[model samples]
Target: MLVTFLIITVTFAILTMLPLSRHEAWWIRGLDFPRLQLFLALLFTLALELSLLDLSSKQTWGLVAVALACLVYQAWWIVPYTRIFPREVKAANNSDSRGRIRIITANVLMTNRNAKVLFALIREFQPDILVTLESDLWWQSQLDILETDYPYTIKCPLDNLYGMHVYSRFPMMNSQIEYLVEPDKPSMHALVLLPSGHKVRVHFLHPAPPSPTENNESSERDAELVIIAKSVAETNVPVIVTGDLNDVAWSETTRLFRKISGLLDPRVGRGMFNTFHADYWFLRWPLDHLFHSKHFMLQSIKRLRSFGSDHYALFTELVLTADTNNEHNGLDADADDLAWAKRKTEDQNVDKSAVPQPEKHSVA
Candidate 1:
């Protein structure tokens, strides 16, 4: 029993410190997802060890200390997402319909053939803007029914799982699709003109994740986010970035994106709202995200029912306000953050020729 406890304690301790390294390898980066699970395991181990008290044995006490340290480290990162911490984005107090914008983002697994389930959710929520990731030509055909209500659209249907589509009720000015990191991986950018005559810049992205089967390194994903963050930092208009970021809400890359772009996360003080691995309740984390600039306040945010995909859709409604003071709600990038973002963007070796010019399109 003692030997088994020692092995478990040491393993958990090593796993806890792996993500602290600066390595971008798939194994090291992938360790960033299960902080919550690690915390629970460490907590249970510590309690079991204490229950079998061995005050005379210094080795047992040493194990207890290590387990406690690992638990605290995990808590430091996981606690901010719980209700114990204050919300980063303020809630909307008024019911002004003109300034309200509703959005829904979903990652329908490429192989999942159930389109009716997703269509049902769309009819129920009736979001102003809908973004779908991992969508191919077949999914595009199925989504064509939405064209009647969503007059404006941007579609990039590919056989690759990275394909994306954006359907909007309002006018999307200068809407274009561009390849930032990988040539085959496409992201959409547009200026959405709202019903209140206000324009909000929206970026829809679904970067490749670091896994044994996918890209071995996370550099491409990090570079893509940094490129977008730098551009968002230069804009003064309202901004909303939504899609399957392919990273957890608390991961280092996502946190850096928030600080550099100065966008606020509505889930900071609410709940984890885990959206991925929808079939397995035990193996899930938040992969879909919708972040907005301080110009908007949160009206409602929810995790929708799964639609035959590995991921659950996210719905968010935000109200644009004239109060500039709300800008303080977002995190500001310091000198180090700016320097890091610059290095990440500059270090990527992107083939300029492979990236074609953005194509503009609109539907009446």
Candidate 2:
């Protein structure tokens, strides 16, 4: 039994090293999604080995060392996300409510017909803006009632799982749908005017995930993000990018996005706020994300009740305020990283980084 367990322990350590290859094969890249899971499993195996196995052999000590290394490696990537670390988005004391905004992002599984649960949360929270993914025509029809309150809207409904829509009470200075990497997959972009008259650039994306059933490589997804990151870098205004990113927060691609764009993740020093796999507790990850520019600070963010979808809605409240301290979570990409980003973005460069001719349908 001890020998069998020792072999399994070494297997997990080997799996942890696979991501270092920077390969995008689904099995290899998927390792990025389960860091927390990996950490827990390592700890459990270590405890079992220590309590049951004799500590005489050098092999046993080597296994123990490898397990500890794996545990620490996973924790290094995740510790910044816990409360023990200081927040990247600071707390505001006297910010005006006019400068505040409540927003929710939910991926209402296209096949899940029960919209009442999601609509209920929408009613309860009454966010200033709502972004829904996998929102086919049926989901749009169900959300049509929201128009009475959220008159401003952007709709792009498709049977494709990548469908998305954005409804807002605040005025959208300009809004359009963009097919950045894949022609079939759509993302929404808009300039929103806050109640305080401040404007922020908002980009909503649902990039296709790398899977056997969907995209076979992460190149396209990485391109879509780096393209946007480059655009954000060139802009002077505040920005907020939110969606079911279909990528974990700690992945190299996501970290590159933050470094290239200079946006801050509120999840840093907060919590994982895992929003995916709402049905399976053991298999869950933070697939949905909300990243904002330095102009905003943390207010409140929570994972809300499910609406019959595979993903739970993420509700976040924020206040517009500049951080006095220059320091924040995440590292800046160096020359090598930037060069790689340039290559990735160029690999799938579009005609112009503009919203395509939108497939707009008003929900009245």
Off by over 4 Å in 2: 326-329, 350-364
Report the lDDT tens digits of candidate 1 across residue range 1-364: 7788899999999999999986889999998999999999899999999888585799899999999999999998888789999898888988788899999999988889999999999999999999999999999999888999998999999888998999999888878799889889899988888788888888899999999988898888988887777677667778899999889999888989999888889999998889998999888889999998889988999999989999999999999998665667767788988877777777796432322222223232
Writing each residue's lDDT as its tens digit, candidate 2 over 209-248 gives 9889887888888888888887786676778899998899
Candidate 1: count of backbone clashes, pairs at least 3 residues apart or interchain = 0
TM-score of each: 0.94, 0.94
Question: What C-alpha RMSD separates each model from the true structure?
Answer: 2.9, 3.5
In order, candidate lDDTs are: 0.87, 0.84
Candidate 1 Cα lDDT to native:
0.87
Quantify how close model 1 is to the true structure by its C-alpha RMSD in Å.
2.9
